[model samples]
Target: MIDEKGILFVLSGPSGVGKGTVRKSLFDRATDLKYSISMTTRSIREGEKEGTDYFYKTKQEFEDLIKKNRLLEYAEYVGNYYGTPRDYVEETLDHGKDVFLEIEVQGALQVKENFPQGVFIFLFPPSLEELKNRIINRGTESEELVKNRLIAAKTEIEMMDAYDYVVVNDEIETAVQKIQSIVQSEHCKRERVAKQYKKALEADFS
Candidate 1:
């Protein structure tokens, strides 16, 4: 049978919504999938390695890429430019490997416009109260920043309908299973099924 087409899986959610956790779980289940590392002009955090955690670049280098149209989608977030490089994603897809990208709402929209075939998944908190608690529990930001993030989270949650699938992360394992199921089901689409059947019929006739 012919191999299924590669898929671009776009995952997005608000801060403290367990996106990273769910993504790691999904990767563990789907071994062949690859996560696309994004590029940013923001300073690298401690212990972050270039080309692994993120493609760290200077502001001037980032601007040069924008001028050359090398990025798939880019946006300035809190004074730093963050974007996905077009080449790496395209290259991965060409080799029939699924590419997973974790991006913000704006970047996700831009990717949808540019790559209409991409599958968009939005992770949602179980409840607004629970979401607020998750942010507070992290203790990574000041109270003021937490408040701002909560506001942003609400806005992002409201935009869930824009995605193709919505998975509520009440439990980590359940959420990961939902994402895995979505990816597996997509591979069995009618188009892919028909292609396989056609090849089988031709082989038999010949």
Candidate 2:
């Protein structure tokens, strides 16, 4: 079999758009793609495992990584730092296993600049009003924080043009279905599959 490099699929959107939820649901079912774990300075939450949820780091450690350019993209949100490690992603793709990155808008943009070939998908809320409700419903953020998130979400939504596809998060199952379909379609693109076929043809001639 021809070994082709794997695709990087980035899932990002406004703060309250359910990117994480959708990603979890997609992975819960059978799939071949690997999840690219992010590193964070924030304290691990309940039920979250180290390396699985995030590679937890101290502020100083995270800053050192920044200095060394070990991270593909990093962002400071609220009071914590979050980023994707460059080595793991590159190595995984080289091994022909697809990678899925569920990240925030800023991080996603940074990844796009570094890896333009990635499939960027923007997960959108059904409505701005619904987005607001979702953020508020979390009960973890202050009223002021909720307002700030909504503002940020509005700006991020405006940047949807930067993405290759938009999947509305009105329903988790529907969004997952659409995203799955997109990944399947991307793999079938002639430009991608043709390379392997061309190699096979050359081998036949040899």
Candidate 3:
């Protein structure tokens, strides 16, 4: 395997940008990429499993992990704390399995600070008005909450430059294909190929 490291693909976008739908479609058509499950202090919602949805932790426990620096990135959203565990990500990459992290912009930025080698992807809506409509159409949050989210979306969009690739989720299938292409192309990068060449040369001379 030439000690090739797996890609850490972190996905981020504003709320109502259809990131979930696009991520699902992308994974369905791809292989070998594992999802990086996060831990949270939020109450388990209906039908949410402890391990599957999130590693549920109490506020104190979550704080302890933060103090110990065991979390790769942590963010408090709407009173609930969510964080990616450092150990899990490290182990997955050590196994040469790509890990996909679909998170909010705050958490994504934090991840970028800790792991600059990660491939950061940002999902966007076609337009601001379109993003508003998408959120309203969902019928999940109250009117006030929706308004707040729209404001937050603007802020998130401004930070798009932090990401390496921007995917517009106007068409789910098309967005998925674009991200798939990015992943495939990243695998062929010179940094990775050079390592394999070095390993082969060493083996031949040994």
lDDT, model 3: 0.89
Give a tens-digit lDDT track for model 3, residues 65-106.
999988979989899998998888889999988889988898
TM-score of 1: 0.83
Provide the TM-score for each candidate, comma-separated: 0.83, 0.85, 0.86
Model 3 pairs whose backbones collide: none
Clashes found in each candidate (C-alpha, N, C closer than 3 A): 0, 0, 0
- Sorted by lDDT (best first), the order is 2, 3, 1
Pick the winner on lDDT between candidates 1 and 2.
Answer: 2
Query: Where is model 2 more than 4 Å wrong at Cα?
Result: 41-53, 56-61, 77-80, 140-145
The candidate that achieves the highest lDDT relative to the unseen native structure: 2
What's the true lDDT of residue 155 in model 2? 94
List per-prediction Cα lDDT, in the order shown. 0.86, 0.92, 0.89
Segments of candidate 1 deviating more than 4 angstroms? 42-51, 56-61, 77-80, 140-147
lDDT of 2 at 74: 92
